[model samples]
Target: MTTPTLGEFGRIARFFKPLAAGFPGARGLRDDAAVFGVPDGRELVVTTDAMVAGVHFFPDDAPADIAAKLMRSNLSDLAAMGAEPLAYTLVTALPRGLDESWLEGFAAGLGEEQRQFGIALAGGDSVSTSGPITLSVTAFGLVPTGRALPRWGGQPGDRVFVTGSIGDAALGLEVAYGRLDIPAQDTRAHLLRRMRRPDPRMGVGPRLIGLASGAMDVSDGLVADLGHLCEESGCAALLHADAVPLSEAARGAIDGDPVRLALAITGGDDYELLFTAPPSASDALATLAADCGVAITEIGELRPGTPGEVVVLDGAGAPLALVRRGWDHF
Candidate 1:
């Protein structure tokens, strides 16, 4: 006999309503839309991200992991803007007759991240799709008025810094694809975990308000995202390849191979915060990093030149060539 499946409204009531229990604005998922107010002296910050099954992840990947990654990716955007988590709305598009267990696991994952990040589900729509499973999250955050960070705030002569090590997620993707041969099980696990669930720098974002002149998360490859900052700020950048931090796993994966190193920088999905600060703020930034317990490394400098021109220098200070800088949706 076939197991009974929860219909649309039944699924929402069973799996999603509890996720909104903490937020009154959600109206227990009975309302047509969410109603909320921003706190006094704070402005709302909003960001949305969408993921497709095959393109973003393996269709058969764990439902819980998929939820965590989706939530954290949106939270990473909020963190880049120096915002604190508030609430979020979700949209799920699944094929007809999908297993109810998938929804159960997905909602469980969302519930776990909600508590961990101090956010709540507001309201959302669930629909049946003819194609692959698709998920979208629109997250809301709040920041002090006039204090949200900007991508165009970088100035020439500012020092560029990144929170946490880079390249692990990129290598993790290779591991997921069975393209990289890593014999060490622990190292392999670390890479795979980083790729699956990214650690958003929420703790560091708010503290970067006056410290970082320009800030953004590294969702795209580090080099490409830095170039985006340069374009927005109308400046150029000089990146020191040797200064880029790498985790033990990433280091082992690269194993002194320049091609792999290039892949690491360009493969994307790191989700770390990349920001620029004036040289004068160096000491304060150092203190902030120590306080937040997240490693912040100075990897490069902004300069006056053609906008968006990123010159990467190797350990020996020679220009390095890359076939491509980052992932392109187009």
Candidate 2:
């Protein structure tokens, strides 16, 4: 069956314009650029992320899931900096012969997430790509002046904490690739969902303003991202391998396999917040976790050592050597 195609202007009028209806700054998608204002005592936070069809996701993955993942991943960046989402601009480079239904599904997914996250589509460009479906979003958010979180704020003796379970996304990627065998249908579904649509810690980020010392979302491996924080903060981290939280599905998938456990620790795309806080903030952190309804687990601590060094100790309290720490796009 041949798929229908619309001209550029027709596509914008029919599909993309509605996404800008709620945001006055979008100018109803009629103007060449978007215009908006940031509140008087707040700073604007902007982040951009791009996803390729074969690189970031399977080429045949559902369009809706792809759209959701792209938007949420950028939102995770904003959350890492303790910002509240406001608006976003999207760029779509789609193949010439793609089906129109794919655009419909993609727009629907973005609309749903925009409503869920209280953000609106501002403005952007779309073009035909000779290669594959490539999408990028430049998300804008707001934070109080001088209150945005930094990667260099961690101090020695500060407790390292992570929001939500770790390694589920990596395991889910394995499930998606058919590399891991799991007999349970529910378990497979859980991991796959975690990979496809990450739950960004939106609620926890804004509240972390006065609490967390340093923070970054776990996009790369946990150990690698912690190393980045340590490098910025001029300290080293001692991570307790046993304390890193794992979902029941992830545990069952590992099944006491040390190799799989290491993959879980080093594999990237978890998107959970890895942060540090002083011991004095423990009670406040516990209360914030309960109020936010998210699991915040203490996995390690910063210490005086070589910067950017991350030491992962096993349950026996000995360092465990690994082949690689995280993903590298280079």
Candidate 3:
């Protein structure tokens, strides 16, 4: 028989079974519905994110990187909620002219991530699409009920925190689009890799368990993503522009003035976590960073809720305008 398009059960059984088996408590992918249970008194955290080629990934991306990033992007969502990964389900649409090689690379990448995180595939649907390939994955996790952080729990004085450097992906996109030519050696590799495979702050999630009042992953530009946090937390934010981390790679990619740099912040696809915790919990972050072995940066603080307003502050707390508005899915 010819290669078959994915039917409901067929595709789910094939892909999800393997993925589910990868996780410990993931019931066999053979039930009416996924029979899932969390630790008693612990709540479940679920998040979904979709990536479309030309929108999320370059049509010319290597299969392995695409698969890896796809999984990471979804997991990043759970990270924002301070959830430990349990399992996930993916629905992918493929373009025609499939090849075994591409599938192999894709599976290989997924397999690597599966091994890294104790998560398994659950189930999903797949089919041929008219244009670009798209992947939508829903990830599951367990968090203590009263401890899970969300995007709307911040108070006015909560200190804003971001994991790792920002704008690497934007710099990566510049290299991808031929806008910037990376010089040889280390910087080029750094920028390229940042665009391709982003490291999610997986370890930090547990530390944020009950500490952060509000949190989210920074898939959009930093400024834009920060705006989202403000909106969710029912507050406004004044960012110390000087404090916004900029990579040497990003700076080299974009010359003076953080205009182009700001673009990278709002351009999306960074996948870092942006969160808010009360100022009293400052030591918790430093200790958490040390305990989790990850770099955590404090960005800003939440103010009274005000929609449609974000001010980039100088070290002296003055306003600055930004070029890009960050990522939008519309």
Candidate 4:
């Protein structure tokens, strides 16, 4: 049967209601807003992220593509809190006409992500816009009351860790800008997919929340985002240049320029999680990696002096400095 033509309101309701059905404590989606009570000893960890067309993504990008990214980006914030994915609220502004094709695909994408991340869609707002489309997603998770990971938790000598690969987005953006080209292989398509849609480290969050002294997602490039972490944790970092995992694709694009490599490291939009942990929790990181089946690389450690210094070291542990600035919004 053909699906019903859900206007803005009907579309949002039909998409989210069934997903939150199993979440009894999520208030059944009947009221204006859902109610969530943090478990007796757990604290609510919530984060919101907004992505605007032309700024966050290309205006011509697919609705589902934007939907998937907004979901993952917001969930990554929850990951930073080391919280269990509980629920989320989405706000979207669509441009021009409401076409069935885009709405169906967009709803499917959000629903698929909610199921994948084990979060419910509680509520949100939507409107037609004369400007480009914009999506804002607010995600919430639960963490042990006093133990939710904070950006200020890092201590000197605590080793830093990053999950999954980096620079895919930087290079992906390069592809978008015609600065680089992919090999046109199945693997390259996969890399493009990674650049388009990233799987947030949901399970890894709660695992590292208490142990990770300071944590944040690598949305902006490594240099820029890690600088935020260091500033929050009140420490400096000596990034092992060789230790920074550059995809073979990214390595090829660098043309052997360490400066470009450094730029990729410092560039934003990677969306991977960057965290610092004490040496004592090293074994736990290993176990967590095994359980989650995702890479958790220990790249560097916090230093006492010089906050925002993400030193890139060569294979022999020599320092590599770049004249170029990483990603900057301004």
Give lDDT for model 2: 0.93
Whole-model Cα lDDT of every candidate shown, in order:
0.93, 0.93, 0.77, 0.78
The residue-by-residue lDDT of candidate 4 on 199-263, one tens digit each, is 78887887886567788888767877777788877778888867777677677666545556766
On lDDT, the stronger of 1 and 3 is 1
Residue 105 CA displacement from its true place in model 2, Å: 0.6
Report model 4's TM-score to 2 decimal places.
Answer: 0.90
Residue runs of model 3 more than 4 Å from their true location after superposition: 1-17, 24-33, 254-257
TM-score for each candidate, following the candidate numbering: 0.98, 0.98, 0.89, 0.90
- Candidate 2, residues 42-141, lDDT tens digits: the string is 9999999999998999988888899899999999999999999999999999999988898989999999998999999999999998998989999999
What RMSD does each model have against the real structure? 1.1, 0.9, 2.9, 2.9
TM-score of 1: 0.98
Q: Answer with 2 or 3, whichever has the higher lDDT.
A: 2
Backbone clashes, candidate 1: 0
lDDT of 1 by residue, 116-191 (tens): 9999999999999999999999999999999999999999999999999999999999989998989899999999
Residue-pair clashes, model 2: 0
| Per-structure clash totals for the candidates | 0, 0, 7, 8
Q: Tell me the RMSD of model 2 versus the true structure.
A: 0.9
Summing lDDT over every window of 10 consecutive residues in candidate 2, give the lowest-scoring window.
Answer: 1-10
